[model samples]
Target: MAQQLDNDLQFEDRFHRKFYYLRLSVTDVCNFKCTYCLPDGYKPTEKKKPSFLTLNEIERVTRAFAECGTSKVRITGGEPSLRRDYTDIIRIVAAQPGITKVATTTNGYRMEKNVKEWREAGLTHINVSVDSLDPKMFYQITGENMFHKVMSGIDAAFDAGFEQVKINTVLLKNQNSQELPKFLAWIKTRPIQLRFIELMQTGEMDLLFQKHHVSGVSIRNHLIANGWLLKINGKNDGPAQVFCHPDYMGEIGLIMPYEKDFCQSCNRLRVSAKGKLHLCLFGDHGVELRDLLSADEQRTELISRIQGGLKEKAVSHFLDAGNTGMTPNLASIGG
Candidate 1:
C-alpha cells in the first residue's frame, strides 16, 4: 500500500514524494571565479540587485517549511561565506522548530576564519569544494592561488568539532582527473569524507562539456584499477551514490547528475537567492515566493503556493539526454 501524504505537508505530490529538504542560496557573491561555475573575467550586472534575503524573511520562510515538515536545510551560494550576516542566517534557520539539520556548501576559502563562529551559531555540517590537491591545479580550476588557505580551513573545521565535513571535487577530464587517487589518499589523513561530483550542465561549465566531461563511471573504473574496491551501498535521496571503499578510512560519494538521473527519488525544492521557489534544479520557471511574501498573504496562502509548486514538479530533467541549455547557473540555484 502506498503511504498517503499528510495534509499539513505543504510540498507533497501525487507521486507520493514529500519535499523535506530546502537548498537556500543566501548570496551570489563569490571570491573564486571557478572555470566550471563562472566565466573568466565575469562582471556583475549593474542593476544593483539585492542578492541576499533579510534575516527575518529567511526565518519566516524557514519556519513555513518546518511547519510543512522540512527537516533539513542547506545554506548555499556563489559562496555563502561571502555574505556579511551569514552566521546570523545560520542561527535563524537552526533555531527553527523541527529542523534537524542545517548545513552549508562553501568554497572553503573563508572557513578557517569563520569556522568557530559557524559552529557556535549551530551549523551542523559543512561541505567544502576542493577540486585539486596540487596547488597549481587548484589555482587553475578555481582561478585562485589560495590552496593552503582552503586546506587550513578543512583542518579548522575539524578542530571546531564538526562531526562530518565533506570535501567535494568536480571531476573534469584532463584537469584534475589524474589527481583523484592522490586526493582520496590525502583526505584519509583528515576526518573529512570525499565526494567526487560528475560535472553537470550548469553555469559556464556547460559551455565546455564537450571538451571536459568526465563521467562517474570513468572515475569508478579508475578507482577500481587503482586497487580500491568500491561497493555501492545504496542511493542517497539526492543525486549522490554512496560508496564504501575497501580498507579506506573514509567513504567516497559519486554525484552523477549528468550520467545518471536520480530525479525519481528527488525530494528537494530550491529557494533561490532572490527568493523564488524552484521545484527542481533544472526548472527554468519558479513560483514567486518573494511576491507572495510582499502581498501580505496569510500563512495558509503561502503554504498553498508551495504545495501548488510541488504538484507542478516535473519528474526529471532533460539534460541527461544531451541537452545543455535547460538548467540555470548552479550559483543562482543552490547546489
Candidate 2:
C-alpha cells in the first residue's frame, strides 16, 4: 500500500494540480438582492437559520486544510463583512501555521467600517464586486442605492493598506456593457485592478442569462474597437486574463468562464459556510465535512476527505453545455 502522506503533505494530480487554495464561505446572509443573484423582493429562507461554522470550527477546518498543504484561504459570503464576528475569524485563520495568505471577497457595502479592522487582523487582499459605476444602474443591479457607500468603502480599503485591491464587474449585455470603457478608464485613475467578468449562470442569474447572454469575447472586441490596446500578460491559472494599457498604471482583466473553460487547470477547492467540501463550482454534490469534524475521528480523516475530493475532481465543468448541478448562489459558494 502507498505510504500515507503526512497530514501536511500537499497533494496534486498527474497534471501538478496544487490544491493549496481554499475558498471558504463564512455565511450566506447578504444585505443586497442583486437582480442577477436574487429575485426582486426575494426573501431569505428563515426555516434554515443561516448556519455558520463557529470560529473554533472554522479554525479546525482551516488547520485541517493547512495540514493538507493549503497555503491560501479566502473568506467569502453573501457578504462576508455582514458577519458579526468576521474580524475574529479572519484573525484566527490568519494565525494558522501553514496558511500564508488570507483574503476576502465582499460586495463592499460595509467595507468602510471594517476594512481597517480587517487589515489589522491580517488580511492581505480584497476583491469587491462593483457591477456598475452609474448609481441608477448600481441600484438596479444590487436592489440597493448604496453606490456611494461602496465607493467610499473601496477608498477606505485602499487607505487601510490592502496590497492588492480588485474591483470585479460582471459584464451584462445592454445594461453595463456600454460603460465598459468608462469603467476601465475610471479604474485606471486609481490603484485598483479592474476585472470584467463574463456573467455566469448561478442562483437566479442562470435564468437571466438565457434571456440576455454576454460573453467575454464581445467585451474584448469592444475594448479593442475603442482603441484600448489589450494584451494577455498573466498565466492561465489566475482565472482573469490580465491586460495592460500603455498609458495606464492599473491593469484590466477579463474572466471568461463561459467562453473559455479553465477547469483543466483548476487547483482550488471550495468549502461552504456549513462545511461542505466542493470539488467543482458547478458540482451539485459535495462531501459533508461537518459530520466528519463533529465525529471523534482524528484530523487524519479530515485530510483524507479533502485529498479524496481532489483526486475525484472532474476534468471540467459542464457549464458550457448548460449543466451546472449546483443550486446555491455564488454568494453561497464564495465566488
lDDT (tens digit, per residue) of candidate 2 on 209-306 = 87656777876776677666756432213567766666676777888886555665576788888889888778868888886666435577877777
Instruction: State TM-scores per candidate.
Output: 0.90, 0.90
Model 1 agreement with the true structure over 1-335: per-residue lDDT tens digits: 11234676656777877777889888776788787777553356457766567787788788778788787889998788888899999999999887877889999988889998998998998899999999999999999999999999988998899867888998888999888668777756555678888777764565577778778887677666767654543211345665655566776778877554467677778898888888877775888887555433456678788888777887677677765443545676676
Off by over 4 Å in 2: 1-8, 13-16, 41-48, 222-237, 294-297
Prediction 1 global C-alpha lDDT: 0.77
Q: Could you give me the TM-score of model 1 versus the true structure?
A: 0.90
lDDT of 2 at 101: 79
Where does candidate 1 stray beyond 4 Å? 1-10, 222-237, 294-297, 324-328
Count of backbone collisions within predicted model 2: 0
Root-mean-square deviation of every model: 3.3, 3.7
* CA lDDT, every model vs. true structure: 0.77, 0.78
User: Any idea how many clashes model 1 has?
Assistant: 0
Specify the poorest-scoring 10-residue window by lDDT in model 2.
Answer: 1-10
